[model samples]
Target: MRSRRDDVDDAAAVERALRLGLVGMGEATDERAERRLDRFIAAPDGAFVWTRDGDGAAYVGRITGPWRRDEDGAAVDLVNVRDCDWVTEPVDPGLIPAAVAQTFARGGRNFQQTHPGDVEAQTQTLWLRLAS
Candidate 1:
């Protein structure tokens, strides 16, 4: 099994592939894209979302500040979106890439995040990164 670190890397690669695919398909162009990349790179925080193990109910949560490492040397993944007063909705995991692209195009910061469902191609979280 791959470590969580590897999983994160894989997710990032997949996201990059998706973005590039979008651009190749002409959905993304250079005309107004520089601002989007700049916006994403400048963000200090990112939104969080996740799904439960049994039922694939998707939920959106507030930004949990910046990325950090725990004392155990493990990277802190994300806050429990399930624990907060988050918004729940039904979403198809396959559609995440497009959503993320849309977010970036609108000058929102976000990156690919790993989830149990994503590994299984079931459901995944779309972390919408935004400037604090």
Candidate 2:
């Protein structure tokens, strides 16, 4: 969702823009959106991120830069972005953990943190294998 504020440098501005209904054609925003934006803005460099494309291609990457507003991304409805050093190849579907697969399958346009026990362990294992 595009924020009305050009300078969305912190979570508070993002929260305000969202609450005022000034983002993305007056789309409804909620606590989840606020939390997601907060995490996106606050995530440290080197944090891992997983995402799937519209074509169902999964990718794994590390955050290499800070978040910023990319006006160029407006056409794609992805104005807020972070630079990532994604693995060159898409991850094999069979290799993805069950929790990760479920996250993708749920199909919401919000960033979410995976559960902490099995999901985290499995993801770390997958990351090690991929990084090697």
Candidate 3:
């Protein structure tokens, strides 16, 4: 549940983000990340999709997927990093990745694969520390 956070300065931001860039965490020790990704895809149809970093704080909604509709309406390669979950409350409607959402929406694609995206997003992995 890696949190998406930023530092006081952009320099700090870049450093922080780059440090853990694709270090492969969460499921690092075990295949937890892979399993989590699998579980995310296995959720009920229409269920949203997101990834929590190893530290558990950094999460970005999988906006686009491996295949996405380009402006021309044709399937084209997309960055697949459009997470809009923060738009609303406990969870917003359309905040999840459009492609992932489509699977749930259409009840298709038994498995949703996680690709490489959002490397810089790891700058400040959010680790929400609840009060003791």
Best by lDDT: 2
Models 1 onward score TM values of 0.25, 0.69, 0.22
Location of the lowest summed lDDT over 10 successive residues in candidate 3: 123-132
lDDT of 2 by residue, 1-132 (tens): 323334442233223323322222111267766667777878777677776544567767666777666664444345566666665567899988888788778764556677655876776677788877
Candidate 2 scores a C-alpha RMSD against the true structure in Å of: 9.4
Displacement of residue 52 (Cα, Å) in model 2 is 1.2
Q: State candidate 3's TM-score.
A: 0.22
Instruction: Give the runs in model 1 whose Cα sits over 4 Å from its true position.
Output: 1-43, 46-54, 71-132
lDDT of 1: 0.30
Worst 10 residues of 2 by lDDT: 19-28
Candidate 3 local lDDT, 1-132, one digit each (tens):
221222223223222322322111121123654564455434443223433223323233322223221232111111111212221112233344344333334432222443334322321131121101
Q: Please give the lDDT score at residue 2 for candidate 1.
A: 10
Which of 1 and 2 is the better model by lDDT? Answer: 2
> CA lDDT of each candidate?
0.30, 0.59, 0.28
Query: Which candidate ranks first by TM-score, i.e. highest?
Result: 2
